[model samples]
Target: MVRNYKRKTDWTEKSKKAVKNGQTIRQAAHNYGINESSLWRAVRNVSAGKSLVSLSEASQSRIIFFLEEEAVLVEYLLKASRIGFPLDTSTLKSLAYDLAIRNSKRSWRTQKSAGKDWLKGFKSRHSQLSIRTPEPTSIARATAFNKTNVGPFFDKLKQLYEELSLTPERIYNVDETGGS
Candidate 1:
């Protein structure tokens, strides 16, 4: 079951605006309808260069990695995915450990690898990416299907179709022979 709640104010945005205008945390809290303590914390974080929006909206649960570090990891993951070399969870954790070591994140140095909780947070933060079971196929088979055969076939088929001025609605490509 899902519960929907209406927000009375975007306290973060209001707090930021108030701080920028030289209002005290207490004044900002009263003006923006945010808890005084939470607004004070938000002011402190904002003073430290963390965005109020992210502070307010992001999950309050413990996070092992910093935002910039996680962003870099996400970039690597996206690039790997584009190159058809997406990492599984264990591999991603290992990579994250390596990243932490390279970036000299002192807290993470004590751990062997990022925990399952960290992985869950990372996944939730990145909604566009999904964990999927890979199809059962050899690397050689997949390479051949994608690089050796499929590309040339599509290129030639496209050339011939354009030469014949085939209408998209009427034209269909179907394999005539089932796999032996």
Candidate 2:
């Protein structure tokens, strides 16, 4: 019951179903009510250029363990870690973070990752670009500035700022040295 360029969610669901049915992307789009370009985008987004995930021994074991766990904490931790949440914290800390993160927005940037299949195919056939390396980028400089070194620089600045002042103890430093 799909119509062309209808609701986005409807399109996605129909597209996903069509793909699952072993239809080629163009064929899938044709039957499921979308254009070739739209179908390509959906397929590319889900597959991420490489083949779809298949169940393997390791995957099966992981699934079994995840299902058998007393709490879903391990599964929760795994999902959280993938999205850049801290999973190494103590139980209480983990719980706190888990609770706090419920309202945080999910990052949509993963789709824009270079491995998208449509992008890969398009670039390969037309632009001759690979996901790992696009066009020629800037050559690496031997002494490129690293943002990671900025913390120490700021600490030194704080020291310098404090040193130039008459009172050091009274100076309220907002940042703790090497703040975690």
Candidate 2's residue-wise lDDT over 14-101, tens digit each? Answer: 7777787887887878887678886787678777854444335334532211223313544565455445453332332334234334
- Cα lDDT for residue 94, candidate 2: 31
Overlapping backbone residue pairs in candidate 2 total 0
lDDT of every model, 2 decimals: 0.73, 0.47
In terms of TM-score, the best-performing candidate is 1
TM-score of each: 0.46, 0.23
Off by over 4 Å in 2: 1-9, 49-180
**Which window of ten consecutive residues has the lowest lDDT sum in model 2?**
126-135
What are the clashing pairs of model 2?
Answer: none
RMSD value for candidate 1: 11.3
lDDT at 4, model 1: 27
- Candidate 1 overall lDDT versus native: 0.73
